[model samples]
Structures are given as C-alpha cells and as structure tokens.
Target chain A: MNMNFLLLLLDGLKGTVILSLLTFLVGGTAGFIVALSRLSPFAPLRIAAQLWTQVVQGIPLLVIMGIVYFGPAIYGIFAVPPLIAATIAMAIWASAYLGEIWYGCLRSVNKPQWEAAECLGLTRWQRMSRVILPQALRLAIPPTVGFMVIIVKNTSISSLVVGYAELSYNAKVINNSSFEPFLYFGLAGLFYFLVCYPLSVQARALERKLNVANR
Target chain B: MSPIVEMRELRKSFGAVDVLKGVTFDVERGQVAAIIGQSGSGKSTALRCIDHLEKINGGELTVCGHALHTDKPDLAALRKDVGIVFQGYNLFPHLTVGQNITMAPKLVHRRSRKEADEIGREMIAKVGLADRWDYYPEQLSGGQQQRVAIARSLAMQPKLMLFDEVTSALDPKLTGEVLRVMEKLASEGMTMILVTHEMQFARNVADKVIYMRDGRVHEMGGPEILSQPSTPELADFVNEEF
Candidate 1:
C-alpha cells in the first residue's frame, strides 16, 4: 500500500488500541465486580449477576453496538458520542464473558483457602483481596489474555454499524474510492494478526506455566 | 476463669444427616484435648463447630466467651480468639511462607509491617522453618507446609487453637516433625483441641481423651482411658487402632 494508505491504517489501529484499552479498563473493572457478585453470599446479587451474563452472552457484539448506537437515537432523546457509545457497548459485552471466566478462576482456587482465610479473622474484603485473588489471578491470566484478543477483534465489528473509524472501517472507506480492496484489507488483516498473535502465544505460555505450578 | 470452650449439647446437621448429635464437651484453658474417633464419628465436625466453621443446628456453643448458638455471633471477634488449621495445610499458594504467616497479623490484627514481620519470623521459627520464610508454600514439603499452616494460625495469637486431622496427610517421618511442633506447643500450655488418629501422641500429650462413636461421646476420661477398657466399644476401637 502507499504511504497515505499506510497512515490511514495506522490511524485506524490507534482507534482500535484505544477502544481495546478502554474496554479492558471499564469492562475489566465491571467484570471483577460481577465475578465477586457471582460468589457473593447474597442470593439476589448472585442471581442478578447470572442473569446479566446470560442476557449479554445471548446477544452478539454487533447487536449490542447497534442497540447502544441506534437504540438511543431511535428514541430521539439524549445522544451518545460514537466513541462513548462504542466503549459502552463493547465494555458491557466484555464484562459478561470476562466475569464468567473470572468467576471460574476464582472458584478454582480451592475450597479450603476460603475456610482458612475466614478462620484467620480476615474480613470478606481482605479474604478476597489478599488470600483468594492472588491465587485466582494466576489461573485467570491465560483466559483473560485470550479474551482480550477476542475484544481487539470484536472492536472491528463496532466500526461496521457504530461508525467508530477503526482499522476495517478506515480500510473500507479507502478501498471504496481506490478500488484496491485486497491490498488495504490485507494490510488491515496483517496489523490485527501482529497485535493479536502475541497475546494468544502469551496466553498459551501462561497456561502451561501455571498448570505445571498447580500440578 | 471458666472453661475456654463449652459445648452444651451442641448439635450440627448437614441436611438430613446429623453429623454431631447433641455433643457436649468442655476444654479448660491450657488443656490439650485429643478427640479420637472413626471417620464418621464427627470428631472433625465438633472441632469445626468450636470455630463456628460449621453452624450448630441445636443447643448452646460458647468459645472464648463468645456464645455461637445464636443467629448472629460476632464472628470477627470469635475468630480473633480462635484459630483453626486444616489437614490440607491450605497455605495461600501464591504467597511466601513469611507472607502466609504474616497475612492475618497484618490484615485482621492491623499490625504494622515491622511488627508483622517480627511476628512472622517468631512463628516460623517456632515451627523450625525460620530459614524458609521467603519460600512459597509449593516449595515446601507436605510436613513443612503444615508447619507453616500452624505458624499462620499462631500469628493470630488466639485464645484457642484447633487442629482437624492436621498430621493425617503426612508420611510417618513428616508426621513426626509436625507432631513435634504440636507437642512443643502443648508444653507451652496452649489451649488446644486436636482430632487425631495418632493414638500414641494422644496418650502422651493430651490432658483429656475423648472417644466418639455414632456422633456421640461414647466414652470420655483422662489419657489413661486409652489403655484402660471403660466400654466394650472403646475397647474394641482401641484394639483396632493398635
């Protein structure tokens, strides 16, 4: 591709990175809360968190973006900025999957650890933060990194309907005028592979290292 | 002072199964009581109830002046006064031995870092693992990890300590080392309750020996009762143990 084509793609990559980071920050925080809620002693909170996961997983990321992007304007009410709308949809979607993944990690830490923490007079918060989370976080790294790869790729779908100016969106616009679909889209595909393949490799490495420790 | 622990007809049920049926026992301060029984005899369940790890379904339970039979006992306060170690060791796998020993002191007791470090060192030394303070739980053998678990409990400075089949998981060599730490603690006059299969250790170290059968105290007396035949069931039980 030409320098101009390369620059446009670089700009799109920046949008994707920013979206992915924001999604991880916002959605990762929510996912932690949801994971805690899933294990919460209160039945209602546990049930509500379960419902949230079920409902979100039932809807695709594209549909979620459409609902957040268009559902607001369809009401002809308060308008959301495209970036904000995309972040909100992508974050909500990530929280459900991340929460479920994290809940499994949390539960996998072993039952006696909970009892031991409790017998030590640790407050529930201390028990979670100090004792349980440290172990769970180890098991969570691989799956969480794997999920982020999914998040980076899914940010592309956000541009299709939400008009977020991400990599594929920019490539499509450039290809429409230039009529060089293969060159531009191919380059966009390579950029995604560059960003995502490392994460997958890292996830695999962490899984192996941690499973050995666990054994 | 009154007994450090008093269970007046304490009853605990897991659904339709009554694990502890109207069990009553008392452990005075500085007394090491050994609870010896078969797998289903509820020795472990009784020890668990003393710390309120398992809720009692019927009767009164009091530990370190905290009555636990009620709906809401001050668990934080009760736990501050009681410590329990499980057979699994249950050491926080990610933390170093020093961190595992210091966690409760720092978090629950809110000891400063310097003070917590001091406590961690002292407790680990008591378990004869002073040099391994920086090592992770996984780095230690089963016996060493169990020793670290004991040190973790000791850092809390509880009024009572409970050991639920602590040495049951270790080999004979490892079990001896762990039991030595426990024997040292008993000599120091720690108020302790242990559920153990080690009949010899029970006879030598325990001030009181309780024999449970069918989720009830079938026979109870001094350590000598282990050698003496008070009941046919206990006689048979002790014979089988030997």
Candidate 2:
C-alpha cells in the first residue's frame, strides 16, 4: 500500500471520530425529546414519535443518506455540505434507535415510583424531572453508550453518498489507486475496530456496574 | 375533635367499574385514623383519593381545610403538606437515602441543599437510619427502606401523612420495627391515615378505626369496635387472626 493511501486512511479516521462524537451529542439530545414524545400522555405526540421511529428504522441508511444528500435541493434550497449531510443523516438515525432505547429505560423504572411520587403530591412535570428522569437516566446510560458505538460504526456507510471523506470514504479512495483490496479494507476495518472497541468495552463495564448496584 | 380532612359523597370509577361509591370520611387533626379491610375493598383507593392520587368522579375531598381540585390545586404545595408512604417503599433508587428524604423539600419547597441535607439527616436519625444516609434504596433491607421512606415523608414536615399498607412488604419481625416508627410519629401528634391489616396496630395506635367492606366504611370506632365487633364481616375479619 502507498504511503499516500495510508494517510487517506488516517484522514478517514478523523472523519469517523468527529462525526461519531457529533452524532452522539446532537443525536442523543434529539433522541431524548423523541423518547419523551413517544412516551407522551397525549395520543397525537405519541403517534407522531412512534411513526418517526418506524419510518426512520424501516428505510435503508443508504436511502436516508441519499435523501439527506439531495433532497434539500428540490425546493431550490442551498446544497448541504458533505459533512453536514452526513452528520444530519447519522443524527436522525441515532435519534430513532436511541429514542427507542431510552423509552424502554423510562418504562423500566419501578411502578411504585410513579405512585409514590403522585402520593407525595408531585405534579406530572415534577414527578418526571425529579423522580422519574433521574432513575431513567441511570437505566439509560448503558444502552445509550452501547448504541453510540453502533452509531459510530454505521457512520461508515456515509462514504457511499455524502463524499464526507470519513474512514470508509478515504479507504475507498486509497483502494481505488492501490487495487489492494485486502490490505486497505483490513486496515479500514482495524481503524473502525480501534475507534469502537473501547466504547463497546466501556458500555459493557457500565452495564455490569449498574447490574451489581441494582443487585 | 374538629375534622381536618373531609370527604363527602366521593365517587371514583375506573372505566366501567366503581372503586369508590359515595364514600365519606373525616379525619381530625392529631388523630391517627386506620382504615382496615381486605384487599380490593377500596381502603387504599380512599387514601389515594384523599391525597388526590386518584381523580374523583363525583363528590368532595378537603385536605387540611383546603378543597382539592379547586382552582387547580397547587399539587406540589398540597403534596408538601400531605405526604404518603407506600407499601413498596418507593425510595428513588438512583438517589441516596438523604437525597430521597430531601428531594421534596429541595425541589418543591426550594430549600437549600444545606438546609435539606441537615433536615434529611435529622429525619433519618429519627427513623433510626442515620447510618444509611448515603445508601441507595436497593442497599437497605425491606424494613430499613420503609423506615427511610417514612423519614422521606417526615422531611416534608407534612400536616397529614398517609401510609398505604407500609408493613405489608416486610417480614413479621421487620413489621414491628416499621410499626414502631409509625407509633412514634403518632405519639408526636402528627395526623396520619394508615391503611393496614395489622389488627393489633390499629387497635393500639388509631384514634379512629374504620373497617371498610366493598368500598364503604362498614363499621368504625376506637378499641371498642375491635372488642365488641358484631357484623359477620367484621367478626369474620377479627376471628381470622384472633
């Protein structure tokens, strides 16, 4: 493999890392709202959130990326930068999965906690903020971190559509020139493994900590 | 004795089934009132309605001289004055015992952390749980957790306290410890409404004992109600244990 090709691989590493961080931060926030909406007492909000998750989850990531890449220009809108499109696409994807993860966490809180909060005379908002969210956050932490690793890995697919120059995109560029499929692809896979393995480990560790504490 | 809590012709139903049907009761200040009944008799529902946990379908409930659901009852404020301890000891699992005790005061009352912490420790100590201040709910035994829950309510400095079969989740040995905490609270002249099956606890502690059957107050009195029980329902309930 050429030295220039390896450098491209390194640039892809930067893209993957930056995009994953942005998705986790921005997408995690968006997902929290979506989760809350999905769990809303109002039927319309719940349906809207549920439909959004369903639609997002059902479509292929590649299709979503294409729509994200090209859909905005249909209204004579300004074109999105490649990085922005990738980030937006990944964030939307993260919101759907994270929303589902968090909703399950919120539901898993003990039933008695709700009744106890109600009896304490907590208003609905107070009950959620003070009593419910704190506990839900604990339950949510492990799965959320775990999902973040998935988000990081899936961002690789952005190479196909956005021209984002992420790890996979750079690897493709290098592979085109080198024609050495095994070496470059394996290196790309190694880059991904390097980025994701520690997060996977951290998430599992946190989950074990939660389980032991709960026990 | 002047009534502090009054429920008149109160009605509540879930879907098509009636849980409370024209139920009425009055609780006096500084009095310990225990509603004793079999499961599903609406004893717990009555307590819940008094605390406004269950929305009433029709009728009136006044707590500490204020009408519930009038002009959108400041629920947080009402809750501060009316504290409830549940059967499951619903202490917030993520928060420490001190945090659980201080949550209402700090959030609802806007007490400073320092003030809330100081008071939380005091309440925990009062319940004999000072050592468990930093412990989470899951760390403590069932009885210890219930005592901490009672302390959590006490931290609110409530005018009225409700216990919904608080000892039901505990073993017989642990039951006495929790009941003793209640006994102490009652001796301190706190107005309390307890829904419990512990006949001896009711006979010994309650200023008023109400025997509920099928959502209505079937019979009521002091120790005399327990001693001279006449109705077959009450007789059957009393005989089951004695």
Candidate 3:
C-alpha cells in the first residue's frame, strides 16, 4: 500500500469542517422556522411540523440521505449534488431535534409572560416577537448551541451514504488500502474531537450563563 | 366620568371546576379598587377575564363602553387601554430596564425609538429608577424590578392598570417600595384594580375594598369594612396559617 496517510487525514479533516459549518448555518435557520411552526396557531401547521419531526426522527440518517440524493431527480430538477444532498439531509435531521429543543424552551416561559403581553395590547405576533421570543431565545441558546455539536458530529455520517470525502469517508478509504485500522481510525477520531470539543465547552459555558441570567 | 370597566354576572369554568361564578363589579374612572381574597378565590381569574386573557364562560364585560365578549372586541385597543403588573414582576429579563419600559410603547403604540426612549426615561425617573434604566432586571432588587414593571406599564399610558398581587413575592422591605409607587399612582388618579392581601395598603390606597371568597365576591364596601373586620369567615380565614 503506497498510500499517504497524512494526506488522506488532511483531506478528511477539511470535509468534516466544511460539512459541519454548512450544516450549522443552514440547519440552524431551518430549525428556527420549524420551532416556530410547531408552536403555530394554525392546527394544520402545528400538525405538519409535528409529523415532519416524527418522520425525520424515525428514519435512519443513511436512508434520509439516499432519499434526498435521489428524490429531487424524480421531479426532473437539476441533479442534486452529493454535498447538497448530505447538507439537506443533515438540516432535516437538525430541524426536528432543534425544533423540539426550542419548543421546550418557549413553553418554559411562564404563562404570565404571555398574559402580561396580551394585557399590554400586543397581538399574538407582537407577543411572540416582543415578549415571548426574546425570553425564549435566552433559554434556548444553551441547548441550541449544545445541539449544534451533535449536528457537527453527525456530518460524519454523510460519508456513509454519499461517500462524500468527509473525514470518516477518507479514513475508511485509507484503511481499506493500507490495512491500518487503528492508526487511521484513531486519527479520524482525533480530528472529530478537535472539531467538537471546543463547541461542547462553549455550550456548557453558555448554559451556565443562561442559568445565571435566569436566576 | 363614565365607568371605565364593568363586569356583570361574569361566569367562567374549566371542565368540572368553576373558577369564577356570577362575579359582578365595576371600576369607575380614576378610582382604585382593591380585591383581597384567600388563595383560589378567583381574584386572579377575574382580572384575567377582564383582560380577556381568560374568556368568561358567560356574562357581560365592558371596557370604556365597548363590550369585551364579542368575537373580535378590538383586542389591541382594549389591551392598550389596560396595563397589568404581574405577581412575579415578569419583567423581560433579557431586556434592560429602559427597553422593558419602552417595548410595548414601541411595539404596540408604534412610538419612534426616540420618543419611546424619552418616555421610558421619564417613567423610570418617576419610579425612582432613572439611574437603573440601563441595568437588566436581574441586576436590580425585587422591589426595584417591580418598580420598573410599573414604569413599563405606565409607558403605555393605560387608562386602567391591573395589579395581581404585585408585592406578594417581594420581601417585606421591597413590598413597601412597590406599594409606595402604587400609592403614588393612585394619588395621581390612575384607575387601578389590585389583587392583594396587604390590608393596610389596600385601606390606605383604595377607594373601595372587595373581599372574594370561594369564587364569588364575599363582601364589598368602603375601607372602613376592612378596618372593622366584621365577618367571622374573613377573620378566621385571614388569621389561619396558610
């Protein structure tokens, strides 16, 4: 095996970083809408959001990626790029979980906050934008940030379905050629740790800050 | 001047339980009425019903001659005319004192930032917290936060204020501070409906005192009624350990 392990590792690390960043950016925004939709006044909107979350949670990530990669073609649209398919799949997954996380925070806002805003002559939209969302976002920050680390880590699975050249995919390719499972996998795990640990720490620190602010 | 709010035969229930039954009251312009009651006597529910926060199962509610029970009772207009100070102070913790005061004015009144800021600063000064405008709710003492909550409500220029046990959650010293602001408001002729157990403050600040018992108005009269302490039920209940 004349493979360069270091080159494979570098390439994989880049994939991990790119995929995680893209997923976080796109996924976070989509998740916000899902969260708000789950709380919508329209019963159909609420049910749609709820069903979307349940369906995403039930399906395996690999199957979802496959569906995303292929489903767009049935409509005769442009061929969904492998990276785009993986990102969309990851975003769907993230929206479900993040929506649930934020819905919990939004509900945690004491009932009086809603009543107080209502008495202040605010419409439902005004109550949400002015009174409720500001408070909910504070409670949501820590958990949302924490869930982002999961989003980052899950990007590794994009390698399984799309065979995207993410760190995990590169490591598997390198190990198959060189037969050095321990070294290649260990390096891949190290790269994952390097990317995720700081985020985990920041999430925890933000959680502490939220607690203090709430207290 | 006309009565600003009137609730006639108001009735509300939740499933098998009745929270308020055939409750009747009127709040006249520039009059402060204090409603005192034991826990679960429907004082809070009545106040919520007035705000349409809880729709009455049956009865007529009118605010400034406009009916409150209609399908669309001009909610924004009604709420604009009525402000509330909650038991928990409920100041938006994420916002500074100034922002909290200015929020509804800017959002509901569509006041410009400059105008709202000026009003917020002026009210903060009135509440004796001009220096604390930039501070967050958590940074202030409970009393100070409650004062800011009052100022926030005042910024809306409400025709009536509903205070639900505003000082119940505060320390004794803090309660005094909050009551002082309220007393000042009452003196300034702001119509207010307050739910409280502070016998002294109610007697001193209110033009009328209402006692609620078992989801109904048990008694209503001048401040002298509370001072004399007539009913055995009232005396027993007030003295009982909660």
- The i-RMS of every model, in angstroms, reads 0.6, 1.7, 1.3
Instruction: Quote fnat for model 3.
Output: 0.90
lDDT of 1 by residue, B1-242 (tens): 89999988888899999998889889999999999999999999999999988988998999999999889999999999998999999999888999898988988899999999999899999999999999998889999999999999999998899999999899999999999999999999999999999999999999999999988998999999999968999999999988
- Give candidate 3's error at residue A66 in angstroms: 2.2
Residue-level lDDT of model 3, residues A1-215, one tens digit each, is 33478787888899888888888778778878888898898999999989988988999887888889878787888688888988898888887888788888888888878877777777889888887888898888888778877876888889887888889999999888889889889888988888889888998999998797677
Estimate TM-scores for all models. 0.97, 0.95, 0.92
CA lDDT scores, all candidates in order: 0.93, 0.87, 0.86
Q: After superposition, how far is residue A74 of candidate 1 from its true place, in Å?
A: 1.9
Score residue B175 of candidate 1 by CA lDDT. Answer: 98
- Chain A fold similarity by TM-score, each prediction: 0.97, 0.95, 0.92
lDDT for residue B99 in candidate 3, whole number 0-100: 82
Worst 10 residues of 3 chain B by lDDT: B233-242
Which order, best to worst by lDDT? 1, 2, 3
Q: Which candidate is the best by DockQ?
A: 1
lDDT of 3 by residue, B86-200 (tens): 8888887778999888888988899999999999998999999999989988899999999999999999998899998999899899999999999999999999999997888
DockQ (0 to 1) for model 2:
0.65
